[model samples]
Target: MNDDGRRTTRMRDRAAGAAVMEQVVRLHAQAPPRSTLARALGARPIGEDTAPWFAGALGEREVGAVLDRLPEGWSVFHAIPVGTRPDASGAVSDVDHIVVGPAGVFVVNTKHHRGQRVWVGERAVLVAGQKQPYLRNSDLEASRVRGVLAQAGIAAPVTGVVALVGTKEVTVRQQPRRVLVLRAEQLVRWLTRRPAVLDAATIADVARLFDDPATWRPVDSSADTVERFAVIEREVRTAQLVRAGWMLAVALGAVAVALPVVSVLTR
Candidate 1:
């Protein structure tokens, strides 16, 4: 194949790959686009809660972009499906990113919690004062990657990486033994500094295994997209209704309290 053909093939392969979670994409698509003028005014669209989705997608893309830029030896896979096929509802489990290079194989789990303090422990993680299973979850993801590689006849060390994006502060109370946590910006430096673990031949072989669509399981495309959008729409509407219900309850309580005061005053 010529250069153009290779480029076209890469593009087609990327299109076929399910790198981002369907739910995340659906939530982002469900949100109305805000104009440049609105953004300048610091205004966001009302009624749709896209904050969580946007942050998550942004972090994934940010790290993916960085991985994409790695010098010649690196190969990065985004939105990899693992363990199961898409269910009846078209929902499938996904891993964020997997990086293979001379440095090693890393199962990179991204956490996009901008402006929120994150606390990490040996076996636990806490974000904004709420406990989360981030460390444990990352470990599981890495193990899954290891399992997949093993099935493909590749015996390689798979490292668990947790990349924190746009965090206000991160405190490591007890360093996790199973996962390496780093700020997204610090990722390139950290990876590049690692001792060479895989040779060019090994990198090429591993990359081929990961690049094959069959390695990831059942493919989910157009049909899954529609179902995911429907799910997100329902979630948004339900949230709006719940907010409205709380507002109604507050108004009724205020009326009840004011009625007693008015009666007392009239007397």
Candidate 2:
């Protein structure tokens, strides 16, 4: 609702992982039966179906946290539902994060490759020696954002960014022609350093357009989505801690037995 008493749907301000979080929640609900014994032994309760989305949700949250610290004059929107997928299934695709500031608009694609090596070349991205289509995908995402703004009678420069999270190494052989690649931790600094490209009024106008839900595809989100995810995340973390404790106990017990045997043999 608005001051005009007209119905309205404003985009969620803190929708960093809303898309992936929905996938995680849905897949978790549909996961096949798991062994109760394995769960008791501290195995992760989430099956393979939901594991990737869970990780993705965490990655977006991390990147969102970094973006949240952006200085004044910058605005960011996350998990923006965009155009439909090319597969013709009518499935909507989403942009991980959209940032509007004095510098320019940025369409950020977040890749969460925890502890993996990432190498970016002029035309390709390799994660742990496996080639990925991140470069091509980012370019298309930026183009879509530009089209959306143009439709709103706004002309702006939109840049594509691939924000890698928790990677062991990010070696850029060469910068991509269309997209910027960097570690998530460096995103805010890089963005802020760019020269001012839009004035305050223009920035506000662009942000207002972005804030309107009609600018993007429709998304189904609940107010309690973040809360539900927090519950699941806590469960996963507790299981990991329990597993680590058991491993430590086993190692210590083996060492304790080995010490007496070693002492007897030495005597």
Candidate 3:
């Protein structure tokens, strides 16, 4: 086929991807709380409410600071999805913040943990006191974003950085590897030091890359993945409630059985 036909195909693919992704998002949103998960383990909820926030309040604040200093024409993409499929991985890595500046696309992961000693690796972030599985989550996100933009016919460099936000007690134990790990204060200064490789023209062109925000969505094939998981969750809850009611009924029966015995003994 001609150029237009190829472009149309890509557009349709992206749209379908986006639609399926939305369904995945909804299922995740309806997920059980950590407290509920804890209860499954015979534990209580440690915190007040269970809605999860990876960045939390302070992470959001510091990111805002970094965004405030960016060049005027630069566009900031907050919580942009980059998965080839829907349903982002992990609690926090899914919606990375991307700042499209004149130089390149900057993919940022904001960490909001305080009093944590962080060891930044080439592809992993060690948080609090434990090392997690290594993966260049930010880089992968940047790559996916580039792919999306490429389909729109724009080629540009994408860079990944992790910004530590609200970490007043954070200490870096080692030098950063391929990734640039810094606090929000440092990130602003670093971004301002150099002009972007992609200026106004390039940023604009890349922005228009794909017009399909719908189509092969997050919920397509992935819908079952989330739905099955949800069914499992609901079943667990139902089982718990059923078990609790049974126990209550048994307790009432015991009370009834003992009542006459107790009255006769007393008389």
**All models: lDDT?**
0.72, 0.87, 0.55
List the candidates ranked by lDDT, beginning with the highest: 2, 1, 3
Question: Residue 191 in candidate 2 has what lDDT?
Answer: 96
Q: Model 3: what TM-score?
A: 0.54
lDDT of the structure predicted as candidate 1: 0.72
* TM-score for all models, in order of appearance: 0.68, 0.92, 0.54
Estimate the TM-score for candidate 1.
0.68
- What is the lDDT, from 0 to 100, of the residue 30 in candidate 1? 58
The digit string of per-residue lDDT tens for model 1 on 1-267 reads: 333332112311442123443555654665677576654443444324445554555578778777766777788887777857665434566778888889889998989888999998887788998998888889999999888888888877899999998899999888799898878888888888899988888888889888876676545334464355445445545656666776788899999999999999999
Better of 1 and 2 by TM-score: 2
Regions more than 4 Å wrong, model 1: 1-21, 24-50, 83-90, 221-267
Clashes of each: 2, 0, 23
Error of 1 at 229 (Å): 12
Q: Quick one: best lDDT, which candidate?
A: 2
Candidate 2 residue lDDT tens string, 39-155: 667889798767888999999999999999999899999988886553332235889999999999999999999999999999999999999999999999999989988988987
Those runs of model 2 whose alpha carbons end farther than 4 Å from true positions after fitting are 1-9, 32-36, 85-91
Instruction: State the local distance difference test value for candidate 3.
Output: 0.55
Task: Give the worst 10-residue stretch by lDDT in candidate 1.
Answer: 3-12
Tens digits of per-residue lDDT for model 3 on 163-216? 776565555656455456777778767877757587678877655442233321
